[model samples]
Target: MSIAAGGFTVMEAEDDYVEYVPVAKRRALEAQKILQRKGKSSSLEEDPEKAKLAEAKPSLLVKATQLKRDQPEISPTEQMVQQEKEMIEHLSDRKTLMSVRELAKGITYSEPLLTGWKPPLPIRRMSRKQCDLIRKQWHIIVDGEDILPPIKNFKDMRFPDPILKMLKAKGIVQPTPIQVQGLPVVLAGRDMIGIAFTGSGKTLVFVLPMIMVALQEEMMMPIAHGEGPFGLIVCPSRELARQTYEVIEQFLVPMREAGYPELRALLCIGGVDMRSQVEVVRKGVHIVVATPGRLKDMLAKKKMNLDNCRYLTLDEADRLVDLGFEDDIREVFDHFKAQRQTLLFSATMPTKIQNFARSALVKPITVNVGRAGAANLDVIQEVEYVKQEAKIVYLLECLQKTPPPVLIFCENKADVDDIHEYLLLKGVEAVAIHGGKDQEEREYAISSFKAGKKDVLVATDVASKGLDFPDIQHVINYDMPAEIENYVHRIGRTGRCGKTGIATTFINKNQSETTLLDLKHLLQEAKQRIPPVLAELNDPMEDIEAIASASGVKGCAYCGGLGHRIRDCPKLEHQKSMQIASSRRDYFGSGGYRGEI
Candidate 1:
């Protein structure tokens, strides 16, 4: 017995007038006839047995359509229910349809019906207790009219199941304060400015929402090439951009398993091939993690545009402005013709940054996890007064006294190289990085240091901004930063994520007069014990401001006397001008007027 054409079973006898042929042979014969449209005879015509078998076969197309295939048995009622679901999904809007398809593909979620694919919940009013809870418990203060629902945990939040699962897999059992508060505002489609400490899990606060919003918008309408990315993340350094790119890539793994196509996340940074980057943009991208310099270059070459971009984020925004990226950042914003949601995250918010936020963000809710520019409460700070000639001796003592996994920060490349060389001569496992080194050398130094191959890493301000090295036991400020905000960021490398660490700084008389007053106050605020030497120096900035205020008339700055300006006073004119010119000459000598005060 054999199953033949149309799934019919037949019992054949040895002498019966029946010819048997395989289904594969019948299809091949039909394909031969179609290919030889010229009516040329094939092997079947030349062979009597094959011809007889071919003649017994039915039309190949009819046989293929009529074949009964093996399928799971489904009851009539169950089949009717599945058909109804298919009909509803087809009639729904694009986002709803996509949601249904995603559910069928194993992406689980508990949110209610999607209203035309809109976010699960709209902006809602909160009670007084809710507001106070966010402020008092989480230390997140909001300053805007946009109300937001409180997200107590990931399970209750409106995030897609794939993102939530990725979070769990990443070992994030609880939401950081920044995430607990910032996620709700951003997911509600409101602009936000987040101020938090280093290693505070601020990256995921915006990244999760950025991906979700971009994907949702893409489902509704596809993005066009050269119209810019759906989401743009700008940082100050190439290293920081690369870190963000890796994080986003990690989160996208679960989404890929849920039958969603892998998104194209591009790293648009410098020190790479520009032509290759341009070619990538020519195809398309969902998200772009970029540094200001390379992104500006791409825009100038017309390789990319941001007219249709829907979401924009600036990580370490204060550092970006300080590094003279203010103009480039503004230029990038000029191309946004459509409405965009902007988010700014920084460890500190200076007055200039506040002004920038006021202009760039539209009624943004300000979220602060701690006081701006305040050192981490978990870090123990210490300062030693060392002369210029004896600084290296003191640094050697500190290194010998401290444990492994130490980071040393220098003011310039010259000091970085000198310190690294001295450490190598002393048989210390160390590596160095600065702006002067090529990209490959910098990357290798960082990698070796991260892998524990090098115990100490010496670098300039390039490493001060956004590099994350886990378990950094101590930070040595070889030279104190010129600005107070920078000191906060430099020492942030240690004492991260509530882990206690130590930071030591070398202070000379030159820094004592300018930085001591501010440093003293900062140390007191962070509850660190202040050194008697630093507590004795008076704040020069305060004295200067007091002198300016006491002189009520147009007078000489040096003598604070009326009726004579500093430039015209015979007693101090030449001396004052010479002093001003001397300071500028030494400070800006290498770069000339380009480094003006």
Candidate 2:
């Protein structure tokens, strides 16, 4: 017997074989046969009647009109390729022109520092006495040579029209004290150490100048791939870094819409994928806002460079040193290939930070808006002796004292979570963020709180430094922090941007006497009502001026605490003990003499 399957003949017998084809192949063959039959039927010469019927009905396999052979249809992928090729050619021409300009100027493409930069004539023409009167009125103390006169109006700065418009849009009619003195110094390409209270618009002091610097560089020569970041802002925390990055973007957007050259800014922080940041760098960026850890990692990995980064800003410099990011920050300085303009802005100026600034900055100007580490006068401070066990329960009453968008700060991550959970269970709209939470969760909580979707935000010290929350009515310290600086920052969150705010701190006996004394002094300095518990704790540094003059440094020179002198600073002792323990550990690792051994 013989059998045929899919056009292949086979013999089925004692020594015969049969063959079969795949179902898909067989179906395709059947479809081809059908198409052949349809083609034969569709021929007008073969069947005129059927052809007329086909013309009346739409044919499935054939088109009524033929496509022109002169112009072929291009696939989406091919079109993209053509466009990319044209872009590459255009970029090449621009690069050639840039190279020629660089050669003529005897400078390299990576170095974009604008030498001999000067402020507008209006600023330069102001006499020293006039500058003094303005600074005195604003309570601004500037220590530097050839200080530029402070601009009373934003217009006097001679900023681009778009920036002025943006200022107007943001409802910032006049510059703050820091912006008044700090802006002119930085704009003049001078290194500066800016000391101002929290919520004093310090961010804008550096941010606006950074934008201007980036714009100047971009206009002079476009940034090529992996070539720039003319401006660099290093913040202590990821939240602060993101905030600064957003501010830069906010300014950049208007400039771009106003038909200015496109300037790119990137946020390089931990918890975000480094690949995305690397991709952005590979393209190019005009400004970079970053935290120390991630920025150091990127530089160490050679994924980014500061070759053209002439403008460097350190926001919350004291906090950066306190968080032990000082080494990472100094290491970053080693990566800069050229002389850079350094700016350090912080609410508190500790001895460590001052020493660090002296070593890092060159001929730096000191712009002090107020006494360093002093409480913000704009904030009304309230101290209550609430028991530690009853704080969570009393949190409800505190929330009521303020309107929506209140910040509750705790010393520990566990407290933040507990407070957050308790609030949620009690039907309070709240969000919590801490170092232990995932980055996405932290970002979500912050965003939700900022967007006014949540009434209260429970957070640790992570939100304390440099995270601006506009219109924050109150800041409640659930637990008094051990460090006075932390207390200052926690309260600073509410009283920001020239707005009056209230800060209520819950204190108990568990808090060290030193901390209590510091808080007492802070409250007294701000002229807030001090409770009996704090009032009874006698101030040890009654003759502070004498001590300050004797020590040649104001406050506790070691820790920047106003309540105690350097000799009595608990923080200094703790640091010394920590160093001793660390040394012991190293000695043990080196097989030194041990009692157990």
Model 1 per-residue lDDT tens digits across residues 440-520: 888899889988999999988888886788889899998987566668889999988778888999888766343456677
Please list all clashing residue pairs in model 1, or write none if there are none. none
How many clashes in each candidate? 0, 0
lDDT of 2 by residue, 1-597 (tens): 678899998855564555679999999999999998878754766888977786788654444244344458975545544553453344234322112323355543322233455667866887988889999999999886667788888777768998999889998999999999888788878888999999888998998888888888888888999988899998888898999888888888999999999999999999889999999999999899998888888999999998898898889887776665655776787777767888888988875566557544666789998888888888999889998788889989988997889999998888888899999999999999998888899899999999999989999999999789879999999989888888888899987877899998999989888889888878777778989998898776774465455445655765678777655677767766866976888978874322100
Model 2: weakest 10-residue lDDT segment is 94-103
State TM-scores per candidate: 0.70, 0.78
Model 1 lDDT-worst window of ten: 91-100
**Each candidate's lDDT (Cα)?**
0.72, 0.81
